[model samples]
Target: MKSLLLSVSITASLLLSPLVSAKDITPIQKKQLTEISGLLRDNPELINPLHSNLKQYLDGQKSLETILKTNHDYLYNNPQQPYFGAENPKLTIINFTDYNCPYCKRLESGLVGVIKKYPEIRVVNVLLPFQQRMIPGLKTNTAWYALNVWENDHSKFAEVHRLMMAKPSRHDSSSIMKIAELTKTQKDLTPNQKKMALVEKNEQIFSQLGLRGTPSLIIGNEIIPGFIPQEDLEKMIAKQL
Candidate 1:
């Protein structure tokens, strides 16, 4: 029974593959599909979970589409959001990131490459501190500090951003403050209420989009969740361009 179920699962995945269409179905795959159909007929319960999951996925996608469409200008053109790249960009990519997220850190280099390669592209950085619960220091966290720097001095924000992203591990309040000092943005170390409010707004947007993790990118109405290699990142950017 275990083997049968595994086979059915594998066959179902193959059926769902983009490369395998009805017209392109091979003989063996057709046989497996027939067997899967038989199994599903015998056990209707198996389809329930799959159906529920599919419905949930479709609902999330629809929600994301609506949010992106409604907040298009805010996501791409918000002056408050700290960004790196062309001052007047032909294209924009909204990056949702968390300082404590390793994947977000990994994505930084690829994102930098994209910015360099595409001179007309602007990458707006939205600091979404999803990992705040796990990390110490709520008010003076890295995300909040970065936002504070951006709000106070736009010129120094870039260096602060770079220093934070360059950290090998998760940043605590102390490390975040050190970055601010290094970048000469340590004068106003006190947590600003306005910055906190902006971070809260970003959290709301993140939840509305149904984003499960950090390192999500919004490019040309498409939300790509998680880290992608430089090559794939370039391809997606090219499509947007």
Candidate 2:
């Protein structure tokens, strides 16, 4: 254990060195950090500093990975996915969110604000309701409702999304359906077969990406998880562009 701590300290030092940038951490170091993160997950004492360094390294490396591994055709070009903003956008942000997540709601507002400011950015919103630990089954209904609305009439999506996020109510099917009715999207989904299938597909996509949780975003090659300020989001977009 002492040897392990020494190794992590050494790696952390390298990350902090004046000459060593995020890109300087080679593939081997990434693997090492990843392993250490997993091993230290149960050790609360050592996890904080280790995770901080790991996050720094990951932030630097994700852009490069995005360039190499991003499936633009699947994420950006797919006609079936719902997106908003400039038709011809300089940057695209693939956002994974859940209606049940407070952080997702916060991020949603931030994203909308940013989009309004920078009309050249496009946002592809993906629903992953089950990602929230606070509310489990309720996410299915909200995700289905949102997707149903998008599938039926994308023109109404923006309004429906805002309503769904804005309505202060408990996370449940009844509340979700009420919001849908208010948004005039209740009729868009019934029998729940097609919409539920699409919801499942979205869930699968989220899982396949190995995303950590709601409010996660794919901006270019960088995977940003959790709620980030609108200003920071703009900066990330600017960096990509």
Candidate 3:
């Protein structure tokens, strides 16, 4: 059996899918191609004439790669939302994180620690929160509350992210205010009554994306679900780097 825990620990040790490299395919694409080729070669029943099919797939891949490489700018040419590393916009990582969720916080720290060690990497923070009816319009209404609290400030989001993973929340509004103060949240918007509608809209978008968990990440065209360790993330990041 595949070690589910090991996979989660490694994957959640942190994240994956693709990298924004100027040349070559992303890590996720490379891994996918490798797996597909392996299965095709190994399984006679799956591909009785594996060699013929493999060449065909490779040819198709090359054509697709060429087309994408030439047209990528037009394909994804939107002013992307940015976060922590916006000032240093080298290679960007878009993270949909929740502070209330423990795993999301864990992965956030691992990545942050990586950033501290390597300041060149740029990470964007998208405030995808997990919320509720009581705090109805905070953001996403899922288990992860920290992300909700984070909407008031991105840096606070990062701070609370680190705290929630290593320690339990007092699990109250006070915790929100405390983190807001500690992290110097921008505008004190957390206490604003009028921002509810905006928060609801944000939550709506999170739901629309079909995400049901904390830390649903987007790196280039790659969509990664859940938290992973730094080592796994580094393996993915190496391609872009």
Candidate 4:
């Protein structure tokens, strides 16, 4: 009985492993899975914990969906949010990004491609600088600087945003301020209470949605967390359209 329980636990863990996919399973593994499935059927109580955990996860996801729906206007249509794409778009997706996150950097090109392909879609940029810290000379935060540039001068925001995103390493106050200077957004880089408030608001919304990390996206009613490939992104957008 003890050995049987151990096998069940191992099999369950293996089944749940992200590294193990259907195509990777061998014939012997398939036979083992079949045997495990039979065991699970016979001893239904063995799976109660797994079932309960899965139910909890699904419930949490549903709750997040509700939150997203509730805050739809503030997230997608707020005038304060900096966005790129069509001036008047049929679809709008919100991006929760951190300047220092490499995954967010990787996802940037994909997002740009999506925008180019779907001229009627808009992507709102929500700066959540989780990894940034205050530098001595810079009066404001890196993300806050970007937000300020966007608000004060919309024309320079794109170049400022691009320079920051293109940095090979994490952005410091100096690097960000240099980009601001280069783009002539330095004048607006002074600390602004309103931009700080907007950044805080974005963080609050990110928390409300239960997002774990940067590069998360909101497409339609679905809240996609983490980096998504351009091809898959297009597919998701197509479905929405």
| Candidate that scores best on lDDT | 4
List clashing residue pairs in candidate 4.
none
Which residue window of length 10 is worst by lDDT in model 2? 131-140
lDDT, candidate 3, equals: 0.52
Clashes of each: 0, 0, 15, 0
Prediction RMSDs, each to the true structure: 5.1, 8.4, 9.0, 6.1
User: Per-model C-alpha lDDT, please?
Assistant: 0.78, 0.71, 0.52, 0.82
Stretches > 4 Å off in candidate 2? 1-71, 131-140
Q: Considering every candidate listed, which one attains the maximal TM-score?
A: 4
Ranking of all predicted structures according to lDDT, beginning with the best and ending with the worst: 4, 1, 2, 3
What's model 1's lDDT at 176? Answer: 68
* Model 2 lDDT tens row, 38-145: 767756677666667666666645644554255567667766667888899988899888877788888888898888988999998877657432233444456666
When sorted by TM-score, best at the front, the candidate numbers are 4, 1, 2, 3
Q: List residue ranges in candidate 3 displaced over 4 A.
A: 1-82, 131-167, 180-198
Please give the TM-score that candidate 1 achieves against the real structure. Answer: 0.74
Which consecutive 10 residues in model 4 have the weakest lDDT in total?
12-21
Worst 10 residues of 1 by lDDT: 132-141
TM-score of structure candidate 4? 0.77
Model 4: how far residue 10 lies from native, Å: 16
TM-scores, all candidates, are: 0.74, 0.68, 0.53, 0.77
Query: What is the clash count of model 2?
Result: 0
